[model samples]
Target: MIVTRGSRLPLYLAVPVVVLLAALPYLVAPPVTRTLVGLFALVVLASMWNLLAGYGGMISVGQQGFIGIGAYTVLLTDIAGVSPFVGIPFAALVAGLLALPTTALVFRLNGGYFAIGTWVVAEVFRLVTVEFAAVGGGSGASLTGLSALGPTLRGAVTYWCALAAVVLAVGVVFAIMRSRLGLALTAIRDDPTAADSLGVRVTAAKRLVFVVAAAGCGVAGAIIVLDSLRVQPDSIYSVQWSAFMIFMVVIGGIGSIEGPILGAIVFFALQQVLEPYGVWYLVVLGLVAIAAALFARRGLWGLATGGRDVRFLPTGYRVAGSQGGVSGGGSP
Candidate 1:
């Protein structure tokens, strides 16, 4: 048997799924289309968080900082005479650049302190954005130029953009996790001191992960405002963004790509059903997350998959026989 790290079966399955999703705009009703736009954005957020905390061993409650910044980037750039559509990438770039200095300051702490430090940094971003008055300050603002487009055209564009963001976030992560950098990330996550001693350049790998995760979150933030046509400092920068990400990653499975996808789906389903319940929905979500943490530490994906090492998006390495016969397997 040709041993592989990730299951080729998932790749085969993805072909038809991609085709179906591509045709979804035509097939689904407007409500479904809108729901999917939000869904894909959640996937992007959860995936980025998973990359940062699960693989890179950086637990950050501050990712909402990037999301708020990214949303503001879209709004501010649009105010500056750039199309919000074009500004999405620039938002990612700015968030990535900002992460360099942010990381420089926060990386000084370790363990739980590091986590708290990230939260503090995010609050600082939120507060700073509030003072900018032009972008609605703390009051928030609506995206203006989009109204020039017909409703149908704007919806279609936003839907497609959301789809693209999802693909980009997941694809970038899959590509990274399959490369040499993935190996370094795994080592660093597992044991930083050992990885460092073995010349793994732990700090560099963590920093790269930080930047990429920030960029991904930035793109997600842009997508959110692009679809909703509104950006608010409080709503976008709320710690709830980080909470949702942690819930998805933890309940789905932190170390695996499929986990976030599954987690987002589950979370979305709950949101749709229980949202009317207001505070009760949050209570339920918290209960579910606590249950997942206590019972299924590897997450629901781990429980569903059992001990089988099958992966849809394989990022790990495989040991193979020279003749492509039966052999053992391992992750990168």
Candidate 2:
């Protein structure tokens, strides 16, 4: 058997698909582009969460805190006389910086406590945001800076930005998972004490992952504001965002780049179908998640690959015989 580090097949196929998707705004109707913006947002959010929980082994449920921070950053930037469109990256920067101090607090806890601490941190952010009346406080605020662009142009630009965000999120995770950081993360995830003993710098790796994930989520939040043209503290900081991330990652398959993308599409499809059912939509989603957890612990992608650890993105090594095709490999 021969061993290979990466596969070119998925990359070859993805180029054309991405090109077509990028051109969709010009080719499709306005409503279609509008809808896809939402989908792309989900893809970005899910990918970030997967990077944190699946690859980094840090299961955070308060990522919405950073989402809110991103949204508010856009609002603040607009107030400072900057275009909200131009403020997108600043939103990510702000979130990452904030995550620095937050890591010092959340890293103190382990296992379930760490998760709960993250949620608490998110709640604190929401509470503090509510105190700022300049940004509409408890009521929320809209991006008045966007008014300079016409509806058609705004929608097109937002669509493009959302697409770029998806690319950025997926590309970052893919690159990280293929680097030494990915190896370090894998070591920590499998056995933290052993990884630390082996000089993996477990805490540093976790902090980096935490900050990067926060930035990614912040980008998603900024896109959400652009898509909706509004941001409410309660809404942006809602715990529901975390739930959506978990559901998408769980059903799509965690620990792999393709899982979140597949999961986001499946989740978006289910949302479209079940949205008209009111609260039952949530009920059905919960039921489906439960079913997936029990029946397919590895997720839809895991099943599609027949539990062989075959990767479309090929971030990890693959073992193959002279006959060709993937034989065996560890999880991405």
Per-residue accuracy of model 2 over 76-159 as CA lDDT, tens digit each: 998888989888999999999999999999999999999999999999999999998999999998888879888989999999
Please report how far candidate 1 places residue 219 from its true position, in Å: 0.5
**Runs off by more than 4 Å, candidate 1:** 1-12, 322-332
Candidate 2 local lDDT, residue 161 = 92
Per-model TM values vs. the true structure: 0.94, 0.94
Point to the candidate with the largest lDDT. 2
- What's every prediction's RMSD, in angstroms? 2.5, 2.9
Give the Cα-based TM-score of candidate 2 against the true structure.
0.94
Which consecutive 10 residues in model 1 have the weakest lDDT in total? 323-332
What is the alpha-carbon lDDT for the whole of candidate 1?
Answer: 0.87
Candidate 1 structure quality by residue, lDDT tens digits, 1-332: 23343445556777788778878878877677888989999999999999999889999999999998899999988898778898889889988988999999889989899998999999999999999889998899999978788876777778888888888888888778877788899999889999999999888899999999999999999999998999999999999999999999999988889899999999999999999999999999999999999998878888898847656777776545476543223344
